[model samples]
Target: GAGVSQSPSNKVTEKGKDVELRCDPISGHTALYWYRQSLGQGLEFLIYFQGNSAPDKSGLPSDRFSAERTGGSVSTLTIQRTQQEDSAVYLCASSLAYQSTDTQYFGPGTRLTVL
Candidate 1:
């Protein structure tokens, strides 16, 4: 992909449902990241993947949240038993290198609304 791509740009789900958001990072990039942004809150890192190393899941909010990056490229973020408070924009970014912060590019984001 040329840049990060997120599916279902807008998702509206009833509380307690599960949702899977997808991200396709740029080709040849080795670093991928997921972030969540609430209405008035700044972006919060959810996870980070670099090559075949263990993913950094430090930012995931709870046991209900999980993610996976396969083939060191595509990634998926899953939120189980979503709640109204879970409504927010999920963003994905990718960089060519783990230290290439200047090269990170963000996706349009998947707006999840649990109502």
Candidate 2:
């Protein structure tokens, strides 16, 4: 019975490099989301996945950011051509569903640093 796990707790990379952050959500979770927390700004939602389909990707800051969930379990957030502004703690969360009442369970997060 694992909660949620994210790999490469700390990622340091040069500017313009691509990084893929992985997340394994709890079993049977149908809703998965990718979020980020940066300096000054509070937590921001990047993408939401219902099963393997991303229905609400409006939160993605730009086209360079994308996410995907497979088999309603695992998910990945890919940052293409990473930038200094993209440096933040990438958080992955899952819930019973996408309803407002559903409590979200978050992972430890992967801290990405763009040098």
Candidate 3:
């Protein structure tokens, strides 16, 4: 893809089920991030992966949420035991590196709806 892209633009899952969202970043970017946007909470960061370094998951709200980047390219965000509160637009972004000066490119986001 030319820029950051996400899969399954909209997902509707039942409560207690699990869901996985995918993000494909720019060809050579090294930094990837996951964020959640909801009516109750604005844009909230969930995790960050910079190169081969361990991902920074300090922003994750709960243990049920997890994400990973494979081969420094595609990334996946998994939500276990989904709840109504988990309904939100999951966003992904990538930058050249994990530097303050790097500009991040954002994806369209995956809208997850827990029923």
* Pairs of colliding residues, candidate 1: none
Residue 32 deviation, candidate 3, in Å? 0.3
Instruction: Tell me the tens digit of each residue's lDDT in model 3 across 34-95.
Output: 88999777899888888745456789889998888779889999999999999999999999
Q: What is the lDDT, from 0 to 100, of the residue 85 in candidate 1?
A: 84
Q: Which window of ten consecutive residues has the lowest lDDT sum in model 3?
A: 49-58
**Candidate 2 C-alpha RMSD relative to the actual structure:** 1.0
Off by over 4 Å in 2: none
| Candidate 2 per-residue lDDT over residues 16-94, each given as its tens digit | 9999999998888888888899977789988888889998789999999888777778888999999999999999998
* Alpha carbon lDDT of each predicted model: 0.89, 0.90, 0.91
lDDT of 1: 0.89
Against the true structure, candidate 3 reaches a TM-score of 0.94
Provide the clash count, candidate 2.
0
